[model samples]
Structures are given as structure tokens and as C-alpha cells.
Target: MSTSTAEGRLLRYVDALQEAFAQEMARDESVFLFGLDVDDHKSIQGSTRGLLQEFGPERVFTTPLSEDAMTGMAIGAAMAGMRPIHVHIRMDFLLLCMNQLVNIAAKAHSMYGGSVKVPLVVRSMVGKSWGQGAQHSQALHSLFMHIPGLKIVAPSNAHDAKGCMIAAIRDDNPVLVMEHRLLYGTEAYVPEAPFEVRPGRARVVGPGDDITVVAISNMVPECLRARDLVAEVGISAEVIDPVWLQPLDIDSLLASARRTRRLLVADNAWLPCGASAEIIAAVLERAGPDAGIMVRRIGFAPVTCPPSPPLEAAFYPNPGTVASAIHAMVRPAAPAWQPDPERTRLSYQSSFCGPF
Candidate 1:
């Protein structure tokens, strides 16, 4: 679980995280880790594996069930010159600590007139699988993006995950690192040393001129699938992954939208004043009244998430659905579904387990 590697090891999403934690704790004597089940046998789904034995109880331990009290303790520790990394098994549980996170941790530096800093890292899992239902599965990046002074980092690959985790630990403010549950099994080439993926930047994953398909978190992989499906129909789409949500890189998005003359935002949340809406508004503001850019938003259906598999399929958008949307946008009269649904639908990896 050492962060130092031979430069090009293929690491899964969970492995990248463990390496980042090991490297940071070893580098900074003042850095410590804490959270629910962080040091237990489960090890927070293996992201904190081997850390307890390596760092010992003082540096790595679990907390009580009280999120608000535990969050306050982390904030106090940060103010006292110690970097604290707090882990949440699910982002849904973060709702219990909103007052401390949004009001105190997010506003400390500004309130103290830059006299103090809160170098706090809050890592939470975000995604859906195996009928976990609504309580355990929610991607609340859009919700946190609306609040100021909070840096939200949702890395889509192993490289970005390791880099962003390291960056968040060293940052002088409260940063939220959101990890998708299904992405844990995804493997990619990552460097062995710790690095930083700066916040407020967007990465252009695929290049095209017909449309700009903006995605975040788990939607990134789905967008890649949609790109291939759309390519078969002679549609070229440029995909953009906004790793940092709060201080969004509007410049890159506007550039893509201007060139493509069409934009589609795919977010993993409901679509009422969500991330998709925010992006569309920003693009329109810069493009002006006469701009012919046609904008559309794709997200979860406006209803409570159902438990049935068939209903869930219709609720969540997949590559097939995304490709169909692009087809309809490019040619309004085109059919929504292809000749066969079985061949078009993409499935998740077998390694994905039900919410624990």
C-alpha cells in the first residue's frame, strides 16, 4: 500500500487512494486520519487498508456515530496546526454534519481574516449499485458546489484520484473528495509518487465539433460509452470532465460549447436547478442572445429512486439513452431507440457489491 511506486503500475481506484493516504501520512508528521470504520477490518472498502498497522492508533482510528461532533473535532484539530483526513462511508451521511462543514470549516479563514487555516480533508463515497435505494446512494457534488469556500474534487480515474487526494490533504481550506462506488474496480496507469491535481480545472477527454458532452464523477465513463455509440451515427462529440465542481472552469466549457454549437450536461443527480442547469446558464450568459447553441440537460428522472431493477433502468440514463439523446438533438426526426436494446445497453462490472 505504499504510495511510492516504479512509475507506471496499473492501480485500481481503491489502490490509488490507499497509496495517497500512505504517502501523505508519511510525508507530514502532523497529518492524521480518522473516520467511521477507517481502521476496522473492512477498512472503508479497502481504501484505508494497512494504514492502521503502518500509522498506529494515534494517527489512525475510528470515531463515534456522531458526525457533527466528530466533524467539529476535526475542525478544531485543523485550527491547532494538524492536518486531519475524515472519511465518510457515504455522502448521504454528510447531511448530518452540514452546519459544521458549511458554516464553520468553510468560513474559518475568511472569518478570522486569514489569521488561521483549516487544512481538512473530507473523503466520501458517492454512487449507486444493487438496489441500495436513495438513502445510501446520492451524488451531492452539485449541492456542495453551491456553497462557497468548499473545494469539491470528484476524480474519474486512478491518476486523478491519487493526485486530487494528495492535493486536498495539503490545501489550506476544507476540501471534499468524492469517490464513486462503482469506480473502485476501474484500473488505470498511475504514478507512484504523490502529486497534485489543482482545483478549478476541467480536462478535455475526447475531441469533437458537433457537441460538447459534459460529465462529472461516474457519468464520465458513461459519457465515453455514449461517445462511441454516437460516433457510429456520424456524430462527433467532445467530452469534458469537470473534476473540480465548486470553482468550475467555465472558460473551457464555453470554448467547447462555442465551437460545437450544442451542449449536453450529464449529471448524476436530479435535474431541477442542478449542476446541468448551472452549466447551461453559464454557457448562455457568455454566448449571448444571438448564439445558436442548443443546450440540453440529462440527469435522473424527477422522482424518488425506485428499488425495482426495471424501474431503476428507466430512472438512470445509460450509454444507449445518452446516444439516443444526441441522435434526437442532431436530427430531431430520428428514432429514440436503436433496432435492439440488448446490444446497446452497457452493464456495470461484476466486482461491484451491494452497499454495505
Candidate 2:
């Protein structure tokens, strides 16, 4: 944690996200909002709150529930040099707009050899917490991360949420800003003034000695808690919260991995070809072949993520899960922590498979 003092207001995670959007809109005229319920009483959560009131309908526009049409419209608007911020209610909802995004928005630059810029940011939430079922509960950001020409932004705290989001709004490429449904209520500190959160920057959340634990999405705070647990036992686990998932902050990650000499990455995306695996590869390439890495990613069980709450509790990654992973990472030799047979997307091909 390089931060000696916290800045901005201590507000909820949702407020930090909103503060980013509000500040960006205030700072740049090119930044504008368009989504399903900017004006409707039934908005997708409350992240879009007060924007319609402040910017007026001209700048803050609403669309019908058609994700495809709105996405296509945003792409065209972006090609015309107007920045558009589109919010889909959930990651699943984005499937409806893939044609516009993948075929047009994502391909426009390379398809034309840098002829045009798509300064569009599509915002969506991973709302798996509300028993929203498989459809709504999926952590689908990995799907976007797979696509080229699209940047992925996932912030774990109030400060990065504000900074990273402002960066996304200003970028020329199409970017995806994913917020977890479970994250909206949690609180963190955020600055009031509009500022810059440069893309591809990651934030280290805790200072530790034994190991460096890099966790993405909402798993960040869990990593912090895991650090606390290890500290109780005299092991220090440095925690890093990535503000930008794609165009990742490899420099920050390498610095921390070098300092700690051992790296553990935690993520909610699947294991075979997820964000965690990609980052583990980066660490090894930067830190050398002899670097010690224990990578752990938590996701739904392939048992279709059984709908039971107790089942979810047992299956999903939590503070306890992270604590156990870190403890094993620092252990001389672990015979206890067996590979979880029930988790999603863990494949032999991806484990420790990197450019190192």
C-alpha cells in the first residue's frame, strides 16, 4: 500500500463508480451517457442516478431495452467522434449486442488500419449475488477480455473505480467497465474532483513481506483479508488490486513480484484461459523462471453452479479460500490443499503456462 493517506470521500463502491462518471462528464463535453434507463424510474441498479437530472436528456439519453440497437448506435456515434457511454444491465445482456461490438466496434480500427477511433465505453455489471440465476450470475468479463481491440476495466476499490473509469471514458478504443453486483453496496474512499486514471495501471493494496497476492475483480478485498489472516500468523502477503484488467499494468505487477519474490494471483474468472492465468504468465516473464508462483482462481462449479446458497458458499472464492491459498503458497511443501475438483474452468493446460 503506497498510500500514506486516503483521499476523497469515504463512500460506497457504487458512489465511487458514479463519482467517476459524474466527474468525467463534468470535465469533458465529448463524454456523454446513453443506456436503458437513464430517465426511467427502473434503472439498472442506481449507478446511473442523478445523471439524467444533471446533464439533461440531451446529454443523458435513454434507449429502449434493445441492447443491440443501442450498442450499434453508440459505435456509429463513436466513429463520428462523439464519445458514448453505454450501460448494459448485466454481462449476460451483452450477448444480444455482440454483432455490433465484435464485428463493428472491435474491428473498426484494424479493419481500416487505424483509420478511425471508437471512443466508446460499454459498462455492465456481473450481478451473480441476487440469486439472479446462471443467466444473470455469470462473471462474463473474461469473454470481453478475450476480444482484441477491446480494453477491460475492473476496479476493486472506490479510488481505482473513480480513476480507472475516468481513464476509460477518455480512451480512443472501445472499453468494457465491469462492476460486480456484490460490489455496489461495499464502501471505499474516492476523490471529488475529476482526475485521470491512466489505462493499464494496477494498484497494490497491501504491503507485505512473504508473498505478493494479485487479485482481480471483487476478489481484491478478499486478498486484503487473506493478507490480514496471514499477518496474524507472521506471514506477510502483499495484495494488488488491478484497476485495469486488459492493457494490464505489468510494470506494477513485476515490481511487486520482485520485491516479494513469491506471487499468488486470485481471480473470479475461469482457469483454463482467464485473466489470472494471463497475469501469472506476465509475472513469470518479468520475474524470471525461478520465481515462485501459486495461482488460484475462484469461479462457479461446472455442476452448473447449483442454485443452493450453501452450495454457492462452499463453491465460490471467499476470504477463507484466499487465506488458505496464500498459506499454502508460502508453505515449504503442501500436501494438504488438493486441487478443487468442483471448480469451474480449471485446466491442466493453463497452470503455470507462461512465456517464461
Residue-wise C-alpha lDDT for candidate 2, range 288-333, written one tens digit per residue: 7676655455544544554466776565676667777777778757
The 10-residue segment of model 2 with minimum total lDDT is 347-356
For model 1, the stretches where C-alpha displacement exceeds 4 angstroms are 1-7, 337-340, 344-351
Residue pairs clashing, model 1: none
**Candidate 1 residue-wise lDDT, 9-40, digit = tens:** 89999999999999999999889999989999
Q: Return model 1's CA RMSD, one decimal.
A: 3.2
Worst 10 residues of 1 by lDDT: 1-10
Residue-level lDDT for 350 in candidate 1: 40
- Candidate 1, residue 352: how far the Cα is off, in Å: 2.2
Candidate number of the best lDDT: 1
Each prediction's RMSD over C-alphas, in Å, is: 3.2, 7.2
- Overall lDDT per candidate, in order of appearance: 0.86, 0.74
